[model samples]
Target: MNILNKTILVTGACGYKGTVLVAKLLKAGYKVIAFDIQWFGNHLKPHDNLTVVKGDVRFPATIPFEGTDAIIHLASIANDPCGDLDPKLTWEVSALATMQLADHAVRNGIKHFIYASSGSVYGVKEEENVTEELTLEPLSEYNKTKMVSERVLLSYSDKMVVQIVRPATVCGLSPRMRLDVAVNMLTMQAIKNGKITVFGGEQSRPNIHIDDITDLYMFFLERPNVTGIFNAGFENITIAEIAEILACKTNAEIITTPSNDPRSYRVNSDKLLATGFKPKKSVEIAIGEVIDAYEKGILVDKEEYYNLNWMQKAIL
Candidate 1:
């Protein structure tokens, strides 16, 4: 599965993580096809090796099984808030279609298939931190669908090589930007308004940069034999520490509130590390980016943010 010169298809290409990874793959000499139902066109990466295909994954026409060496499944109702918006569509497109994609790819002779699962699958790790072996207790709709979809995809292990990477709450830069995440939101609030609302600071959740996430995919794409599910994330920090540091960068105030343990506990990515993979960007680096974006006046309006509506519906 050496991606060099291999034709690779990246779903959700316009998304934060997908966009970054698509660019990386294209730059690394992989034949890249980008697919997405919609586009933040202004943020689209202009590349010679990239071919943009506007399509949805739910429909068979969009799967593009032919001539595809690997399928990176990133298309879905990503955030918990967005998934709960329309439960039925979420399953049909995000969960059910993953199974359909696997069937299409494997039956069509696609070599490698990767699923972007979430750390939220491990709800609340009763024991301080969680690991890949921990039993899943997904508390939200998006993660529930992810867990179900993962099971369905894994069923094809005998037919074709399938791999899953359960990334922690991803933060940092993206072409199609989103500030609905904890780090992004805190940095925006502190910079614009000089204050940040903190919730459940005591809870430690694993976090990783958007770039590092793409790196994980590249590693697996190059070494397809590295199969199975692996956890991805660097340090597990509490909401309070994040708020404090973000405020430090912005010279803003910190506001703490009730339990807002929206997703999960911390996770141990040791298993993934054993695969000779180390995250290039850390949580601290993500913080720096957020602060830099804030100072540079790039933080968009709350209403204009892609994830604002989704977050409001779920958090409220």
Candidate 2:
């Protein structure tokens, strides 16, 4: 299952995680095929050993699956703000596109298929460590579609070596930088406004670094012996705790508000760790990296705020 000799197709290759993962795949010497519609519905660049396909996943289309070893389906309009932008568009792309991908990949003899699912698929995992077997209670429209997407991908399990990973709220530095994440937003507020405001500061959330997230995908891709579901979070901390971490680094005031924001949960990534996947980054690391970038003037804001549609993390 070495990636060096394999050919893999990663959907939405221009995204925050996708771009970073694509770079890693190339470094691993995989014959990488990147499918994306960056802007104006076009695949921007061409590289040696890399092919960019410009098309929408919502529409049934053919890929160069003849000798492809695997498919990492990372394309999706993730999050409530982004998905709610256009409900019709979200449904078509997220759920419908996923079904087409599974059906086509199997028919094309693609043996391994890795689906980029989310922890949001399980709306709230209360007391116990949330595992693959937890009952899903999706609160938002975006989450509902993701739950459906995972189910559809699972239906093709018998044909393809399907592995589903429900990653926690991803944070960390990226070349395609974003400030929409809870951690990133707090960092920005602490730096510019001198204070960070948080809603439901007591709400516990599962967090993971961006690099750790990419590593998990590659790990699962190479390990065919491991199948089924796994959670992808490192530390379980509260919202207030996240702000406190940034405050220590940025030296800003923390403002708390117990809003009925309706979001809280903790994840158990023990299953993923059992597969030799140990996350190297933490909330502190991510907060520090971002704060450093801002203080050093490397990531000064041209945009007043981050938008779900623009933030590359919105790509599941």
Q: Best candidate per lDDT, number?
A: 1
User: What is each predicted model's overall lDDT from 0 to 1?
Assistant: 0.80, 0.80
Best by TM-score: 1
TM-score, every prediction = 0.92, 0.91
Candidate 2: lDDT over CA atoms? 0.80
Per-residue C-alpha lDDT of model 1 across residues 166-205, encoded as one tens digit per residue: 9988898776777778787777778778888877677777
TM-score of 2: 0.91
Q: How many collisions between residues are there in candidate 1?
A: 0
Q: 4-89, model 2: which lDDT tens digit per residue?
A: 67999998777667877888888788889887756313323456988887777776664555677899988887678878877888
lDDT of model 1 at residue 165? 88
